[model samples]
Target: MEEEKKTVRAVERALEVLLCFASGHEWGLTEIAGQVGLHKSTVHRLLATLEDKGFVSRDAATDKYRLGLSVLELSANLWRSDDPSVALLPEMERLRDQLGETVSLYIRDRAERVRIQAVQSKQAIRRVATVGARLPLSVGASSKVLLAFAEASVREAILSDPAWPSQLDRSTVGKQLDEIVTVGYATSFEEREPGAAAVSAPIFSRSGQLVAALSVSGPSNRLTPDRMHEYAPAIMEAAHRMGTISG
Candidate 1:
């Protein structure tokens, strides 16, 4: 005979209490106890635990409890893994067609920037970017944009590490990063690869966290500094639109 599977009653009850908020309504302790068929003290204990862990929030004045920001965070993580780039692909293609350049999506991964998606330009002479390519987080437009908008601790850790260039001009880089923040975009010319130039902007989550960089790249001859400045507004606009659909 097959072994019987046992479940923890306390955990089951806690989950049921959480599910009660699925109706998008707040509940008082006694009301939740009645809904889950538990004692008032039991429900109150469950609510305390969940609230402490950020799974629920309580209104002190009303003495009511509701779902918390952590629930949205979990769903956002799932959506990011499965659908972020997919949802942005159409916008990427649109930008590529409009600018006649390659449009790529980059996310910072530790000390590198990973190209998770790209829509290459139709022109034969244009720059080619491969999806899943891992490049340094030190020189490209997308690289600097990612670093400039990264968490303060993350940026400090990477910049202070000996692995980074020892001769880097700290003052200049600081000002450049500050400018990126003020302008909402970044540009580079032959900084990562000879004959390559690009403009990039930050894509942010609904919670205002920097999630990725949206970039347009091409040959330096075609993407001159003046042209990059001209394209910056479009890049920033696309990034803003992309951020709206992100978590």
Candidate 2:
């Protein structure tokens, strides 16, 4: 028990030291120690341990430490374990082909929905979202799908935000969200981006948590009201495929 306790405490201290680099600035031993409230010597030992593991690197010139490529390697490995984007690509491609419009996958990050993957339609006039593009979680079909299935606390927090886009009528949006949850998908027209329309459905993890949202999007001219309705089932089928395959 004593040895286990020591091991846990050491792990915690090491994590605390690493977190000092969260500001993205190179950190010196003194700065890290001060930030983590540990002795400089202890911080140095922790940094050395982390450096050996490739989580951080020390600059010989400035005697400062920055995050190392090993950290990125670990990040890549972690995401690769059950990456939603990777699992959804095949389905997204099928949906894009079927709808002949751009299909994007989004995952919520706090107040934002970030596009992690997109398959563009061959149509010259079709809409496209770049991977890593961050869009507001308060608007659009993908964002609405996320909110409709998000935890109550997250939903309340966004709805409570004073600076949330003024044009989105919450009452009307609330009713629409209820319908989205009931129907298992969302549709939006000219809400997030003017002249664009999208249909989105939630992708769930094995545990049934909403892991991401998949969307089909295009210019409103091509995705008119009837067309959006027409495309809904394909999008839902793709969403289901993503959820089924994604861990």
Candidate 3:
């Protein structure tokens, strides 16, 4: 029993080390050690094992570590089986083509929103999404859309958290979520990334539960609020179609 408990604890620590990268894409050994509250030696050993398993990659030049292809491969497998990413790709692609902007699918993961699938535009200048990338649920259009439709408990916890980004006003967020629900979509301009703008609509399950968000993102100059409003119908239509197909 002692040996089994040790093994379980080791596994838990390794998983915690891997999860450290979710906040930022890369980390140094000491940084990860600090983040996970483990000693440098233990973190190093866990990193070595994760590196060997292709779950993490180390930058030879900078000596920083980032998540590896194995993580995306697992995400792809989930996408294929029952994640709705595969089923929704065609709609995402079609929306990208129609809007001439990058299209992405996002789902809530605890206090974050994760990009599960993306279709890039053909234009020379456009937004590009990295699959499996986790973003804060505070400022982006997709994140707001997901939050607007999320369960009341989940919504309250995030809004009430003292760590919530200072730039966001909770009362305003409340109004924005209400507007998103009333308008059937949400738009953000330079809210998170400078020069970035997006319009997102919620995708619902057959039972009317929110499942994901479908978004069209591009340069703020191009995806202006006026333009985003113009594109809203198309995005909402595609989101509805995606929900229909998945259902």
Candidate 4:
């Protein structure tokens, strides 16, 4: 039993060393050891094993280890496989064409918002939100909608984090989220990025749980307050359609 526990601790320490690389930093043996609180020899052995498996590699001159190409290839493959973003691309494209603005799909990762997919309109001037971009949960129409529909425990976890960055007045955001929950949709009047306005609705599963958010964004001048209201019904309809298909 003691041997088994020691083995588990070693594995956990090794994983901690690997996680230290996630900061996009090149780390030497001593640095990795210090970060994971393991002996230098233990760190060296673990790094060598990872390098043999093509998970880590060392620079020829610097002798510092970094994530290898195999890790990136594996990540790319996982990103493309039956992801919700890929499943909804066709629908997103149709919506972008109909609305003449960029359409985006986002999912919550704990307290963070990640843009999973997007379709851009062919307008001469366009607002583009990049796929795979991450944003704080306290800002943006899509993020706000996701937070409003999220489970109370999850929302509280986000609010309890002292490190979470909030730009707007927290009380105002809290009040606005109530309205979004009541209305079943959210809108941004030039919040988040400057000169960009967006309207978003929550996508719910067949079991009535919020799964994702769908949004349409464009220049603030083109998506004025009245225009956002005009487009809200269509956006909500699209979100419902996506939920039905996904479920």
Candidate 5:
């Protein structure tokens, strides 16, 4: 005898509700209902379930819904895998060509970032941080990224050390590191060298350990906030692709 197949409408609706947030924006119940083409009560009930599971959150002031920390946790897992160096360099060069900015790859070297790869921009006014150059992990975007995702022991050792850079104190630097973990990237504006601005994305090894950072930097005037925002998505997309390939 053949048995009829069964489907769960509630589960399907829940997934659709989650997808509505793909634009990186928040939503209210009515808006979510409209987006998902569901009844208002049904959407509200689904939201409650997602909230209980730490998948969504509601703003008390605006009564809007947003993705929760759980999303970040899931993303952080991707950054935890694969040593992506070989798979990353070609794309980095391509990104450098596409953006007309300096691209650099760095690996953690005991609380510092050692530039292991780079592709310089053609523009004469561009930034010029060369390979094998060592920079403090407490100041620049690349170094801070390595620090943020490092193992607890390594992270604590550097942060609590007396040698923490005199230019930026531990607490301030610590907050910045926390933010990097939350947002998945880092930014620096002439903090290391005057006239330079940069944004950086982290690279991870296949086993999920922090390995290196990839960055794009240039003259601050040209690498303005809008420019960085425009380029950030491509930078992150390249990183995520490398993440999937790094051994």
Candidate 6:
């Protein structure tokens, strides 16, 4: 039992050392020990084990430790595995083919909307936002649709975060959110990225919980205000189909 306790303690110390890199700063053994509340010698030993496993690295000249490339690679692999991107690929493709533009799937993580999947159109003038890109919740039509349908507590928590970015047109967010709920979709023209227009609708699970958002984006010239009004119903219908399949 003593040996098991010692092992757990060691693991905890190791985790603390790794977490010390969360500030995006490099630290020497003494600094890490002070932050983690462990002796310098114990911290050094833990760092050595982590370095051997390629989870941490030390700068030879400064003797300061930082996260290693292996850690980043591992994180990327895990993110890909856990992402909703794979599940929404076929739907994205269908949307792209139907709209002759870009189709994207976005999900809210904390206070941010992350693009989990995208299918580009075959047009010569296609939009180029890639999968895995992140956007602020206050910026895009897709984000507004997502926030509008999210649980009240979740939306409140997101709005409560101090790190959330400010919106360019702050006055529209509240009104747009209300419209998203009332009309079952959201539309925008050059809201986030200039020269881009989008229409988004919410996807729900079998239990009637909002899971994510589906959006069709294209050049502003091709996606005029009149065209967006016409496309809103189509986007909403696609969202319903996605919900049925997802359920």
Among these predictions, the greatest TM-score belongs to: 3
Stretches of model 6 off by over 4 angstroms after superposition: 1-83, 163-172
> Highest lDDT among the candidates is held by which one?
3
Worst 10 residues of 1 by lDDT: 75-84
Q: How accurate is candidate 1 locally (lDDT)?
A: 0.90
Write one digit per residue (lDDT tens) for candidate 2, span 1-247.
4664335889999998877776656998888888889898888899999999999999999999999998787777665636877767878788877779999999999899889989999998989778878789888899999999999788878877897888888778778888999998889889877899998889887789888998888999889878888888877877777777986
lDDT by residue for model 5 over 1-247, one digit each (tens)?
7999788988999999998887547999999999989999999999999999889999999999999888878867654323344457788888898899999999988867788778889998889867667788877878878888888789899988888867677788788889889988888888888899999988765678666788999999999878887888888887776676675
Q: Write the per-residue lDDT of candidate 1 for residues 48-135, one digit (tens) a residue.
A: 9999999999999999999989988996765454466788999899999999999999999999999988999999899999876889
Give the residue spans of candidate 2 off by over 4 A.
1-81
Say what the RMSD of model 1 is. 16.9
RMSD of each: 16.9, 7.0, 4.6, 5.2, 19.9, 7.3
- C-alpha root-mean-square deviation, candidate 5: 19.9
Off by over 4 Å in 5: 1-87
Clashes within 3 Å, all models in order? 0, 0, 0, 0, 11, 0
The Cα local distance difference test for each model comes to 0.90, 0.86, 0.91, 0.85, 0.84, 0.83
**How does each model score on TM-score?**
0.67, 0.68, 0.82, 0.73, 0.63, 0.68
TM-score for candidate 6, residues paired by index: 0.68
Q: lDDT tens string, model 3, 3-61? A: 64335889999999999987898999999999999999999999999999999999999
Question: Arrange candidates by TM-score, highest first: which order?
Answer: 3, 4, 2, 6, 1, 5
CA displacement after TM-score superposition, residue 34 of candidate 4 (Å): 16
Q: Which stretches of candidate 3 lie over 4 Å from their true place?
A: 1-9, 20-37, 48-76
Candidate 4 residue pairs that clash:
none
State the number of backbone clashes in model 2.
0
Clashing pairs in 6: none
